[model samples]
Target: MSKDTDNSNLTADNSANTTSSPSNDRSANNVAPNEVTFALAQSHFLVGDISANADKMRQLAIQARDQGADVIVFPELALLGYPPQDLLLRPSLSGRIKSALSALSDIQDIVMIVGYPHVDHHGTFNSAAILHNGHQKGFYHKQFLPNYGVFDERRYFDKGRNQVLFDYKGITIGLLICEDLWEKSPIADLKQQGVDIIVSLNASPFETGKQDMRKTMLTQRSREHKVPIVYVNAVGGQDDLVFDGGSIVAQADGSIAHEAPRFLDQLMLATLNVDSNTFNTQEKAPLTLSRESEMYQALVVGLRDYVNHSGFGGVLVGLSGGIDSALTLCIAVDALGADKVYAVMMPYEFTSKISLEDAQAQARRLNVSYTVCPIFDAVEGIRHTLAPLFNKSPADTTEENIQARARGVILMALSNKFGHLVITTGNKSELAVGYSTLYGDMAGGFDVLKDVYKSQVYNLASYRNRLEDTPVIPERVITRPPSAELRPDQKDQDSLPDYEVLDGILTLYIDEDMGYQAIVDKGFDADMVAKTIKMVDNSEYKRRQSPIGTKISQRAFGRERRYPLVNKWSINS
Candidate 1:
């Protein structure tokens, strides 16, 4: 939280950048009277591609210099992307980062602030440094390490204590990385010190309506401390996390001057004009998106990048003619062209004619590759094999699972042979209570809607189709009740609560972290709450084995949703 004009008061190093220019964007009248502008650089950073990551930043530093940016800030762990996790234990990683910093210093005239982990005599710290021409200007460790939810920063990084302020082109700047801005102390200290502006570098993960929260936090802080703030966030997906990169600028009067696009990589340039006469942000064209649209866009970018970056030529989705798969198909088609997506309609004896018709219709509307892969022969083969073991019982879920597993095998064989990423379409409700099969429906390279609740899946599907010209997802998918089509007369309602009621309780139980008694007290049926809690508790093992999906909510599968698979505690007892 470096505020005020700390850098404006510093002595110049005899460079042309330090000297005042009449054409400068901001006046150099304050204590640190040098004019400075910064660029927020982001990329679709790959996991463990240290050299490539450093190279991208080095190029960006050069580009920023050409664009008149005095200082350039990059995302958290810009050298390795977010949640490098235990890779920090490599020991040589820190040395590579420092060397990268030194190389940047050798290149240009502008200060570059790049985020990386620094190991020193004090301890290991999540750090960002200010560098110009290979010399260190200042370095600050991230103070707050968020341990809750998907973040386990405390396990990897030692807490940063000191706030490092530096002189950049005659202006004082303080740096805070990611979680440091979430707490009060960093900004509060900057306010007390009376610096100019606080520039926060972040790799915050995406969730529904997160951009609104970013605006509110930055604007409120700027108004509270009477200081402007530039928030730069990382973009693209890393495992389950996706960064929206909606880098925003908020002035001291609680007004937003500019915002970057969501879920896409773009350079954001915000020029703030400041002097004793007026402290105003020169307005740039504002980019706007509704909350629903933002969430949808995040999913599309995430799916596209994950599929393409992983070196897959295209994607394959099992179209059950359900909302989840239909929405996933639309997103895939939108992200990669219709040429890159392939929809497989794996209809079975139990699959309704409407479901089959809808699947074919969606494929035609989207104009992607489509084929019907009937599983009757494959399922019958498996059933004949199981018949030898005294199979005298009535056909139950086991028979139904065989059908799903047959479809899964067909998709996976295609995945192995053709190198297409299979996207699972199961929603959060089915995943929450073991409604999905492990090797059957859950088999896939990725799950696009794993975090989306069943109820929201319908809305998102409708919204996505409406966003496009024609209705890609048929009307029957939205209006029809969800069913696994395992048995002749089976529906999802036979095993679980209705999705509207079920998703409501799940949001309370999982996202809100409410206990069983608390959920029951919220006017749900006591018996229903007890049974659902047991199902959720029992399903921990299945969720653990589920494919890592993009986390669109506060608590999604994989990193965020972690429960002991062998737990025996019961809240109702």
Candidate 2:
């Protein structure tokens, strides 16, 4: 049952309740003879797959019970998956949720807190169900529905106005959904009811420093409330979001007792001392990954899940011997393994000899299947066929574009024949200002570096080389001048500003959403800012047709930033 709305205390007296068996002594308070064993299952669930998710929950529950856990907790929306997005609107989902709940009742030994969607006469709600001894005890609806960037929970759920408290053996416990722990009201309300511990179910997505933020918040909450906390989070990639399963536990003193490894699925077990209001874990806290390592894992997990969930056989990368393609190839091999990755180097007449050598060296180093397909014949054939129609027009970007399109044709043909998904290699800087040829280098099912800037591309390559004992990308690929190699001595700087300057301008204008004048105020050249903004504005059509990619930054092209393709509101600095 829900608590009273008037802030009155809602307490259920379990002093005499002896329905469930106790694992430890119940009366001694000096030494915490009575302790609660909590199993935090940091699981990776498929979105909208109710049956599979329910089955996984059952398996995890049985495993926890076998380990002598008194209660177990799953992540937010574990049964229906997180951010079911508009899927909650479907009437059929209610039936599937019911079936899942019925299936979850089969585990009869331990108590489980499972997150899912709940419906009633009022409306739908993001809720958590409490199961004890194979029966539905009660449930708690999420109180705060986050509505800011990437979160639109208010559109689907009615805010829960009460706290849910349950009794496990001789100890009193409470539950909070993902966003509820972030606010002060929910925990304060639970404190009013005298909860011994707080168990949070989360589906928190990964940002650069999100794990640290979580730990800080949990520490503050525990110390402020003088109550320990056990947090369980969902792990895996869903679309553009990647949840870095870093489930944690904090004692009343605001000290971390255990933290699960990032980007992994784990079952965290801990013991809560009721008398001392502290908890401890046998497992050591996982070492925090470096910035590069964290971002790299995010890309790998995002690509792996997308490929596996989408039912693709493998990935094919267009290795151009440049930093962008070289980094993309390394990510592909790391994500799907070398055997599953195929590297193709399509060189034309203008392609440099050094580029050819670097491409071959990288392919051999990574142990991926390599192919050298010369596109000179294809480029000449197209030009020859169009010569009469054009009346012998002087060669321009059209010829350069033809070379790129020929390479695209080869990659797509290989994909069609072998069922391998093509991975595009264009970086964010080129994409920001329309430097990339649409349907040429952009022709792929996925763009691994669509959100990564050209400046970041070099850093990632160096990071990869340093991460491993041996370098997979050659030194020439990392040190050489960036080029399209579609025309002789064609350097990217000749067409656009230096990547360091261009990337800085794009981040301010695009990611920060600054005006042209505002960007100039940030110590940037006014002419360059205007030119870059103009290119970005004109390239909306190209971006609209670009493939989706993993979102590693605060602002990415596909879902994070949305701009109208035909808007005429240009800022005149």
Q: lDDT winner among the candidates?
A: 2
Model 1 regions lying over 4 Å from their true place: 1-34, 277-285
Residue 262 of model 1 has an lDDT of 78
Looking at candidate 1, the ten consecutive residues that score lowest on lDDT are 13-22
TM-score each candidate. Answer: 0.92, 0.92
Cα-based lDDT at residue 230, candidate 1: 78
What's the lDDT for candidate 1?
Answer: 0.78
lDDT tens per residue, model 2, 1-573: 232222112223221122322222223223233566789999899999999999999999888877767678999999998868999999898888998899887776567889999987878988888776556767888999998767889889998877877665445678899899999999998888878788899999887778889999999999999888888999998887889999998888898998899999998889887556678665556888887888889988988888889888899988888888899999988888999999999988887889888999999999999999899899899999999998878989998999889989999999999999998988888888999888899999888888788988888889999977988889878898899987889899999999999999999988888998889999999999999999999998999898888877777887667789887687852
> Which lDDT tens digits does candidate 1 get at residues 75-146?
888877777998987878778777766666676566677787788777788887666555565577888999
Local distance difference test values of all predictions, in order: 0.78, 0.84
Q: Give residue 331's error in model 2 in angstroms.
A: 0.9
lDDT of 2: 0.84
